[model samples]
Target: MSIRQPVSVKFILTEQTKQQILTEQRRQIEQLTAEMDQIEQQGKLALEQAMTQGGSAAQEVRQQIEQERNQRMEQREQLIQQIQQIQQIQQLELGTELQNMTVETMVDVNVGDDWGMVLMGSEIIIKDGIVHEIRRGGQPV
Candidate 1:
């Protein structure tokens, strides 16, 4: 505790050094801006060339996109039609089979207005062999 010791200190950038660093950063930013401008110009030139050369490439790509869209739409329509056709066929087949089954009596049954007849047995209620109702199991006939 007799002699005092000097405290160690870290060096910091002076104002001149800070100014130099800022100048370098500005120079780098200007260089990058110039490069970006050059790249954009090159892209524009390429697009111009593509446009001048008959423009067939772009047209072909557009046609391909349109064709693919049409194909998908056609496929979707076909699928929907197929589903509808299958449903119709199933309904017709079931109705035919139901009409072939015999019922004990056709009492309390109307040609087209009997909910009880429509829910009873595996019978397709036919006025004259024309299907009026489709039924399953035995509820009421």
Candidate 2:
């Protein structure tokens, strides 16, 4: 029988990869800031439109806008922290491994197979956006 298993995909950190990460993270921060600004403008317009309805209606709109603002703020903070972390990664020596993502692979499981070895999982080491090596059972394959 064959079953799906998760394999670890790791990156061997290089200057190129670091810069790519930093660039992507900074882009996200810019996008978040723009969204926050647009939200504020829309909220102000909404408040003006709701004012004629009644106090309660405007209050509800205010609350909803506040909630949206809070969520976006939290997301922006998280991105900032990630940017800091990437900066720290920049300080690390080249070729250090970083966990990139997980992917599933199919493995053949036969009767009497050593379950531990069967489920040991695998890892693909990437360098400069290329697959450098693969390991299974902690040994290069």
Candidate 3:
């Protein structure tokens, strides 16, 4: 039988990787800022229209817009924090491994298989967009 397993993907810190991460983070920040601005403009127009129609309706619309704005603000803050963390990572010595993401793979299972080893999971170390090493149970494979 075949079983699915989760594996961790880690990155070995390098100058190139650091800059790539920073670029992506900054792009996300820009997108969020643009979205926030768009929301403000659209909300203001809608609110004004509602106000002309009814005061109570306008108040409700304003609340909804505020809620959406708050959500965007929180997301922006988180992205900023991630950018800061990436900057800190740059200060670490090269080859320092940081968990980047996760992926799934399939493994063939048979009777009497070592469950401990099979379930121990795996990790792939990447450097400069290439696979540097693969480890299973903390041992290079």
User: TM-scores across all candidates?
Assistant: 0.30, 0.91, 0.88
lDDT of 2 by residue, 11-96 (tens): 99998999999999999999999999999999999999999899999999999899999999999999999999998999999989
Ranking by TM-score: 2, 3, 1
Number of clashes found in candidate 2:
0
lDDT of 2 at 55: 97
Give me candidate 2's TM-score against the actual structure: 0.91
Between candidates 2 and 3, the lDDT winner? 2
Every candidate's CA RMSD: 38.1, 1.5, 1.8
Candidate maximizing TM-score: 2
lDDT of 3 by residue, 1-141 (tens): 998899999999888998999999999999999999999999999999999999999999999999999999999999999988988987889878988999998888899988888889889999999999999867899
On residues 32-98, what C-alpha lDDT tens digit does candidate 1 reach at each position? Answer: 5555555456655655666677678656555554555565456556555655554454444222322
Off by over 4 Å in 2: 111-114
Give the lowest summed-lDDT range of ten residues in model 2. 113-122
- Candidate 3 Cα misplacement greater than 4 A, ranges: 111-114
Candidate 1, overall lDDT? 0.45
